[model samples]
Each structure stands twice: as C-alpha cells, then as structure tokens.
Target: MSFAFTSRRLTTLALATAALGLASAAQADNKNLPVASDGTMPSLVVTSTVPGGAFAGHNKRGVALDAEAEFPASRLTAAEQAVFAATFKPKMAPYASAAEALDPESVINSDRRFRVYPQESGYPYRAVGLLTFNQGSGSFSCTAWLISNNTVATAGHCVHSGGSTGVWSTNVVFYPARNGGLSPYGSCTATRLHSVTGWTSSANPEYDYGAARLNCTVGNTTGWLGRAWTTASQVGVPIGIFGYPGDKLSGTQWGGAGAVAVSEARKTRYPIDTAGGQSGAPVVQADGTGPGTCQGDCGIAIHAYAASGGNNSGTRITQAVNNNLQTWINQP
Candidate 1:
C-alpha cells in the first residue's frame, strides 16, 4: 500500500516453483535456464539446424528474429555470417560460439555476488533497487536485497503491485545496484509467485513472506543466497536484510543497517525497522550458517527477526520451506 500502517486488505496468492520453468529448485542442481533471446519473449530452445532454417518469427524484442529475416541466408559469406551470428545468438550458458563470445570477460563477471552480513564499512553485498509496481496507483518505489546469484530476497508487498495480470500489476521487480544504481535488470515475467500457507490465509505481515519467480535474468547477471533449512533455527542471532528502501543513493544505501536479530516464535512475528519495500529479503545469521532467514524477505518461515537481545520477535521464513514451493509451481 502507500503506507505501511494502513494495512491494505489485499489477498495474497501462492505459486509453485515449476510454473517458472526454471532448471531446478531445492538445489536440484540443474544449471541456470537458457538466457533470454534478443526479443523480449522468453528464450526459445532452437537447435543449430533451426536457426538457419525453420526459425521464422520475430520475438517481441525483435532481436531473436527468424533466420529467414536475417536477409540472405545463402548468399552470405563466412565473415558476414560471423557478424550476424554475434548479433543474434541465444543461450544462458557461457557462449558456445566464438562470434557471440566476444565480451566473455564482462559476460562472466556480469553477475555480482554479495554477502548480507559481517556489516563493515564497505560490504558490497547489500544491494538496493527500485521495485517498480502498480498497486492501484502509477507511482513507483524500490526494494533492497543481499544476493544469491541473480536471486534476491525482499518482502512480498514490495513486488505485489496490483491486480493479478498484465503490465504494472502485481509481481514487482528488483534491480540490483550496479553502475551506481542506474542500469536495471531487464524485467522478468513472474513465472512463479508464492507465500507461506499460514501468512496468506491469515493477515499477519510478519509471516508475509512471498516470493516471485523471474523468467528473465536481471542485468543478465547472477546472484544467489543460500536457503535456510528447518534443521537450523536459532534465536538471538545477528542477521542481515538488504533492499532498496524509499531513501535515495546519497542516504543509507544497501537497505540500511543489517545488524543481528533474535529468531524466536518462528512465525507470527517480524520486528525489523524497515518500511513496505523491504519484503521477501533473505535474512542471514551472523554465524554464516544456513537458516539465512532474515526480515525484508518472505514466503516460508525459518527464523523471526527480533532485536539483537531477546526483547523483540517476528517470523522466520526461509527458502528451505519455500524451496519445496517448486512442487506447486504449476498445479494446473
């Protein structure tokens, strides 16, 4: 909503991971999905034979056009073909063709890894980005995060823009701060969206942990946060939660303070001092262990966010529980 305390009476929804069509969930260890094509459409898996033959449609981005559209497929020379190939190659893995592999260095390091905790002066891990949404209004906002390989964690509310479909609706975006917070990760379709069974059913904001799956890569980069498991839920632990809060670049960047917090009462609690844009963030414990459950992230309960001491408390939602969410990604 426009304000945090107003408490918008909106119903939260859940999406299974498979709906995203991602390679693997739960660290099933599948590789990253293929990179999207030049066109805005999701990348299609075309065989080498198809590129020069059957491929005949131009995707929305117009970059992944049919080979027939490349002009003369036969009269083209090797050098000419090489130049064309570099322009329209597709695949998420490191390039297989030398033509497309021109900028290997930049492509490889494109995804910047970041740590959430051990808050020193310059922990480059914390990332903050605008969470563009359309929740009944046209205004824009932001969210922050700690990376886990193109994967970021923040609150559900930040991404839930408005209705359920179309542009500027629910399923907001996260743009990791690179290039001085200027460039943005291309908007990915919400392949899968979800939240804990408990939170959506009830009206608890602390347990309001919801996550959305992106079919497109932001920044064409990578970032990942290890999922916290139920096996390790500790209270009174220091954790970090990063996101692009309402503030600006000059102010507290990287979603502000990532001090430690207690993890009592796993669910039905969240005492972090962040506003709306900090939902669904991955909370990391200071010990560097699993249970990376922290506030500003959502979906499954792992550990609540209480004060450093034991005075306060909140819910603990982690990918560990949400990890299984892949099972329900596309039930239909």
Candidate 2:
C-alpha cells in the first residue's frame, strides 16, 4: 500500500536540541507489554492488540565510535582507488553468503560529519525515527523507518538479540519524524516482528535485516518509502540515512547522505554517519523525478553494522529480502 509524504512540524530553535527519550516517556507503561507470539523467527508474526508489557531490563542504546569519521579523497593512493573500483563492479551471480564475504577496499562517505539532523527536511528524514523496546530490566534503542503503511524496517539484531540463543525483543515502539523529545507522527507499538533465521539462529550479520508491523496506521499520515534490490553497478550512487544516534544530542534524530561504497547480495556499505540507535535506519536512494518520486524514496537496504570506524554497513535488500518484505507488508 502507498501513501503521500507529509512535512513534519518544526519546533522553535531552542526546543529543537532538547533530546527526548522514548523509554522514559513510556516507562510507566511497561505493565502493558505485548505478549510474545508463538511463531518462530525469520517468519512474520502479526498481532491485533496495541503494544505494551514493558520488561525490567535497562534501555540499550547503539553507539558508533569511529576515530576517522570520513575517508579523505586526497589520501586515497592510485592503488587504493583501483582496489575500490574493482571491488564495486557489478556481479554476475548472487552473493554466495554475506556471512563469509570479505571487503578489503572499503571506503567511507565524507559528505556528512557526525552530528544532529536538521529539524525540517524532505521525505527521507520524515520517514525515519527512533525505536525503543523493553529488554530484561531496561529498554534498548535503535533506528527504524516506514516502508509501508503498517511495516517498518530495521536491523534484525535490534528486533532479536543476535546469536545462537537469541530471543525476540518485546514492548517495541517506533517514533517517526522525531525531533528532540517531539514525536511528529506520535509513536506506535509493534504488533508483529520479522527477521531472517540466519540472524536469530547464528547471529549472521548478512541477515541482520528485520521488520515490524505496527498497530497504528501512521503511514496514512507521514507516508512511507518503497523497497528496491540495488545492483553493484548502482554502487557509488548517492543515498541518505536519517536515524536516532545515542552519541548525538541525547538521542535526537540525525542524518547523512553518501554513495554506496560496497554492494553485494547480503549487505551494502556506505559512509553515512550512524551509531547504535541509528541501526535500522533506511538506506534510501532517490527513486524518480520531481518531488515525492518513487513513493518518497526507494529503500535499498537496512542499516545494521559498522567497521573500522569508517564504513557504516547494512543488510542489502536483495531480491529474496525484498520478497520477504512484500510478503510481510501484504499480510493482514
């Protein structure tokens, strides 16, 4: 299902920087945590009731610690440039396994320095926000965005703690177009969750992508992004990511735009600035012409991990994953 994108109301300059913590706002609502469904991981589970039942675990926020923020173009030697060019060539076959793939010539986008996102922007920023959930005695936070009216995409580890013994996260909430403590479109609890079995069972980073079905139809109000399975030839194409990062002003929303550094079947690497809470932020490319093109923006991948402090990577929305998202979105 598709909807028109809406502009977020901007707050006064002084109030814009004051960060709002969703966990604290809804902490008292913990008793209302939603009951865990019986369905298995990697499969979509849908619930009708509103989200609630907060647990006792502390809130875990994601953090990005990169000493070298963006890569320097002038510093790239001729040999390094050749390596990057070769590594990003279009592939003839699908990726064998994102879990075992190695990228030796990874680079970072230098367009944006790690910082806060402007309050008012276009569709890309409007579709992104903060996601918080109850884990044990505290709540953990990550970034997430709308791909459809009821579906929000994010990192699998954010939905289910990765590893062999991973368990689903409960009492999840999404705050779209959040600025400071303000939630422009309000917040909704996840009625259902979806992730790949590879991530839930083995904590495979390649399968880190995940999605949530919200009880609220926020898409009708704020609009949503479209999904696309990008190719290696599309590598270096400009993309933008808007999300909530813990290192920034008290978890306020922030964003950065850059090109795809590495494109593979399982994951896509870019220089977009992100941290812990930023996981799950949609890595989107401009879809079509004019304004509101390609249903606001085409979601290329789900931002999940970072390495060497230079490149922030995500689970590329391959054909298989794209099919899964469509299946989940079409579910009743």
Candidate 3:
C-alpha cells in the first residue's frame, strides 16, 4: 500500500473556514460540553473530577511545575475518577532517576545500540519530547513528537483513557527537546486533542494513535517530523525511536536504533529499549528513497507497549489516522 501523509498549505482563509466547520459540528454534537476559551471546538472533556485536592506530583523534570501541571477538580467528575482509578497501573521502573544524564552511552550501557539524544540534536526530532498530564492516581508522562507547526502525535492512551470509561486525559502539556529536565524549546498546553473512537471505546491497541494541537506554533521554531505508511521492505528499514524513558532520567531525551522485526495488521514490533515513560515516542524512519522518505524522515508508528523480552511495539499509522490528523491540522 502507498504511504499517505498530511498536506500543509498557506491558506489562512481556508483554515479559518475549516475551524468554523469543526466548531459548528462540536456544538451540535455536545452543546453541554465546554468549548475552548477562544470559542473554538473544545478539547475532549474528562467530565469527572478527582476528589480531594489535586493529587500533587513532580514532573521528574527539574523545572518547577505550574498550575497546568495539576488537573483541576472542576473539570473531571467523580465518576470519571473511578474509571481512571480502575485502569492498569504498571509497576514503577526500578532504575534511579537519570537526571542530567545527557550522555546516552552511559545510561543505556546494557545495550550498545541505544544512546542519549543530545540537546542540540537537529530536526525533525528536535521537536520530539516528553508529554505530561494528570490521571487517576497522580501525574504521568509519555513521549510526543511534533508533526506540524502546532500538532503533536502520541499514543492513544496518553490522550484518552480508552475503554467504556471514556475518561479523557486532562491538563496535557508538551515539552519539546527536553534534555535532563531542560525544555530547550519550551513547553505548551494542548489546546485541542484528537484520538480514534476505536481506542477511546474499546482500548484497541491497533488504533492507539492520538494528536494534540498546541497553544502555539512551536513546531515552526523547532521543526517537526513527517509521517507515512510503508510496506514490509520499507518497514524493515532501520528506524530511530526517540523519547524520555522513566528509567533513564525522568524527562531526559533518549534515542535508539532498531529495525522493524515484523509488520502486523496494525502494529509493528521492534527490539528498541523503552520503559513506561517512553510511551508515545515516535518510531521514525530516517531520510532515504521511498514513498515516505521525500520529506526527510517520517514517523510510521507510535511507541505504546514493551515486554520483558526487550521487545517494544507501537501502533502503526494508517490512512484513517492520516485523515484525523488532517482534520486536526485544518482546525483553527
């Protein structure tokens, strides 16, 4: 199958019109739901609030956390909190925090293929970094990569608490090029979030894909990655996985190289080293000749799960995701 990608143009008027269309549809669909402060389509609401004071926590990144770091009680209803509490909580990583551990060679010592991505790493991955938000127990982190001037792609679970719960994530923020607790390109909150209904409803791993629209166009300053689908041959090509693994130094950028071992219907397997915080890291194929190679490197999958055998897997990006991404990109 041919790889599909999102197209960007400089049509201000067209974008404005599309935004209006999305806003109208959102109102008709859920008028009771809150709309974005700018009168645009509101992000998916987490209706239930976490009881008691907001569960206070640290970002692992050394920077001081902000009010956005906590999920306010008014947004999420009590019912939603129960759904979030029921979600699986994987065991916490044992490795001590690798803060300020910029040298990847030292941290991923067990594996020769993995290395730390330096602070000055060039685009398009320079826009990839840790994504943080509030859930049931407390705050959590994942990986997210910029795809457009203001759009970030991450795993579905990071955006929505998929299952019958419909517990959408709240107070989400992105830290681009974060290295050892430092946000080199700064951070921003997600103005709008999008994810597949299959994942939101059934928690399907195959459909574990999501995107967030940032409050500002940070990608233009840091650059963003392109995305595409590929056949077995292209899929097998060596690809780079970038993210902040909880085990490696909380919120520090890490990089590793691995080739796709197999391509399933909607997922790809790789032996990339990753931990809990690495979820949503982009599995990106580097610049080369092929359908998805024209725009330097293109992201093909979203890092989602890992196994004890050292095998890590992600949700394959499909045409449906491409269409959703287009809808998000065109929104005002």
- Each model's total of backbone clashes: 56, 21, 7
Worst 10 residues of 3 by lDDT: 47-56
Ranking by lDDT: 3, 2, 1
lDDT of each: 0.31, 0.56, 0.59
Off by over 4 Å in 2: 1-37, 40-111, 114-119, 288-296
Compare candidates 1 and 2 on lDDT and give the better one.
Answer: 2
Candidate with maximal lDDT? 3
> For residues 1-332, what per-residue lDDT tens digits would candidate 3 score against the true structure?
45444323322345456546445534543311221213355322111111111111123466432223222112224565344323322222222123312121122225533546544556655668778886555567778988777788887778776666756677887877766545555678987777755676566656667888888666666666766664434446677888877665455677788787767766777767666677788888766644444345667788876542335677776544544555556567
User: What is candidate 1's CA lDDT for residue 22?
Assistant: 29
Pick the TM-score winner.
3
Model 2 Cα shift for residue 220 (angstroms): 0.5
- Which clashing pairs does model 3 show? 47-77, 48-76, 48-77, 49-76, 49-77, 98-249, 104-116
- Residue-wise lDDT of candidate 2 within 105-124, one digit each (tens)? 12244435444442355455
> Model 2: what TM-score?
0.65
Cand. 3 TM to true fold: 0.68
Candidate 2 lDDT at 288 equals 54
lDDT of 2 at 25: 18
